[model samples]
Target: MASRSSSAAAIGRAARSSGLPRRNRRRVRRLCNMAGPDLMKTKLYSVSPPVKAKATNASLSGPTRYSPGMSTSRGRASRHKKTFPVPPAPREFQQARSRATYERILAAALELYAEQGFHATQTPDIAERAGMSVGGLYRYFRDKHQIFRELVHRGLEQNRQAQDRMLAAAEAGLVAGETDLHRAIEGVVDWTWKALHPTPPDLLRTLAAMAYLDPAFAELTEQYDRYERKALSRLLAKLTSRKRVPSPLAAARLLDLVVPNVGIWTALHPDEARGVKEATVEMIYRYLADPPE
Candidate 1:
């Protein structure tokens, strides 16, 4: 009995050594009891090295290493961004004073330009007349040409405003059943003659010369001419029927030519200025009243 027990125990030990399950080891024991220890002795076994589990750390998986020069997410965004300069706002008083200075400069330049003529006038002369340093004058206007351009622009603007007011008054008068061509011609001629009377012949000649010489002045003169023509056309349309004068544009052009020459003739010959104006009014009225064959 002791010997049989020892044999079964040896078989179970061998099965366990072979990496068999507990149930399989029991079955092997049973089989060993039946088949004896001879099978167990025939099996060969070898030992394997034990594997150690790696140690897990929460801090090791937490974050990457931070270098000295490395920036944070927000800092990195700001580092590559560009900044721009903002201009200071102009004050109201400063702007007003600037405008006053500009007007004063322009007035002085016009006087100098009128006295010395545009081509003969110098920047130093303009600055002295303006009662400002050359540098101060330059702050308002770049050069003599620029000053002349401004003067021309101012004169043109004034003339345009005057013409517009006159046209409006004429339009109002026409709407109120006033249709006397002779009276209208007299009023227009007198107004234009007076406007041109203040302007010196030298200044007028200088302006005319610039209109021919300078491209800038030529463009300005053309613009003023177009404006005047349009205003005249409006006035003519009110006075005459479309059937009688098919194109007011043509009539306006002819009238424009007559008026300026009259103004120039009157300006040159002040002694006969009134007679020239009355004759101009009569001639223009007659031309409009009786169309040429």
Candidate 2:
């Protein structure tokens, strides 16, 4: 009986000691659960605590430097050449958007041609100014010369129109108290001034200089001069009486020499050519009214 009791007491003591460790372990698990997922995972795994924390941090931290193969904010690279954008044409035309295109091209060409000489003014430069391709410019004009010809024609036509108005005003009795001869001379001078004063003085100068080089240019210039002379001659013929009527050819030649030559001089040497206007009208008056002694 004594031996059996002693064995039972030994067993009871072993159970109490084991139950104490299990109760302590359960309490530890409860505390870890209260501390949150991080603590719970750290406690559940016998891992080095910091190693588990670091792994958890990495997993929860979204994308960052350590992420696999991340993309950056830099722009895409292109394979083709970089091209410039073409600008809109300077002038707009209603009748011929195409005609407007041509005029815009011619306008730009004339500006460049005046600023820089004909040889220097390339179609590419003009095309750049017009905001078009060189190929597109060719569709409108065959060559630079062709464009020049048209520009001159347009300018001359504009001058002719203004002359027509002046003549009408004269016939309606609006002269500035001058003789019919002086009135005719005044018309010529006024038209010449308007022509010379256009935006680019160089264009007309270049045209005149080019005439010496190119026969076609020479012919074109002659046509314009002939138109001027013809207009003057017609005016003189209308104004002069049967007896005093000066020769139309002579009068035209004289007026042409007086007015255009003055413009040419002024264009060539703007500094030396002041008072051209008043001086020209005075000279014309003296040449016409007071014959050379």
Candidate 3:
């Protein structure tokens, strides 16, 4: 803890001496502090693999970032919209042993979901991975779906927090040092690509399958989209020079839908990723930046 604080303070001092615009410098200091250590490795927005049957591993790196801005408006509005069918964990998390058991189950489930996809990963598989009996697992979770639901919630929340941080940074006037639309889009693609890295293809496919079984999962997705679209719309309005945009809300919707799938797809098939990455950037850039009819 002391070392981490010292590192943040050192970065803060460096920013103070740097010739960057005062506002920009201040933003940098804030980001460094928010990120704590390993600033460069931390992505602008690290979206977990598409709802991972795994939805997401809550262990994704770096601290969550958000600020007072358009990025959080809809997020705040839809925060309470979804209701879980099962309690995330019926066990008391306050006890050390109980908390450890709960986390073990989740970690085990996340691994199995990645390896086998959501449907194929049974309670037994999770219990085996967690080194617990099936009956033991049930004491913490009523069923596997409940565990899945909890993971999806954690993953989505993590992704949302990262997205808000990225947008907030952008809104704070950090543009990845690009002014042109295509370059900006490329940078965006690159950042997302790095963040996604790789996720099992089967996990990517499981999002739809899981959504069917649990309407709550679908509801959570809808809620996220609503918040994401609004935030993206605000970003488009601010960044674009043209007075008229090609339905900024529509464009945001497209990105909010497309980016995760595209990311996961590319991660599993790196040979095809370059083409997909370019295509995604072009499609999104035109959708967001092109002049209105």
Cα RMSDs of all predictions?
31.9, 31.8, 23.0
Q: For model 1, which pairs clash?
A: none
> Which ranges of candidate 1 are over 4 A from the true structure?
1-97, 290-293
**lDDT of each residue in 1-293, candidate 2, tens digit only:** 56445534443444345433555445544554454445422334231111111111111111123211112221111111122122223345466779778878988987898899787887789899999999999887766655665666576666667777776666555345554667666766876766676546777677677767654445545666676678667666766544444586687788777687787777776776668777888786765564545
lDDT of 1: 0.69
- Which candidate model has the greater lDDT, 1 or 2? 1
What TM-score do all the candidates reach, one by one?
A: 0.64, 0.58, 0.61
Reference-based lDDT, residue 196, model 1: 85
Residue 293, candidate 2: Cα error in Å is 14
Tell me the tens digit of each residue's lDDT in model 1 across 101-186: 88888888778767788767888988888788999988877777666655666677778789888878877888887746777777
- Which residue window of length 10 is worst by lDDT in model 3? 54-63
lDDT of 3 by residue, 1-293 (tens): 87787767776666666545577667777877787677634555221212212122112111123433324444333332434332243445678998999999999998899778876777898999999999999888877767877787777676667778767766665355534556545655675667676545667667756566644567767777687779867877666655546566876677767876788778778889888888899888776665656
Candidate 1 Cα RMSD (Å)? 31.9
Higher-scoring candidate on TM-score, 1 or 3: 1
Model 2, stretches more than 4 Å misplaced? 1-99, 174-179, 240-245, 268-274, 290-293
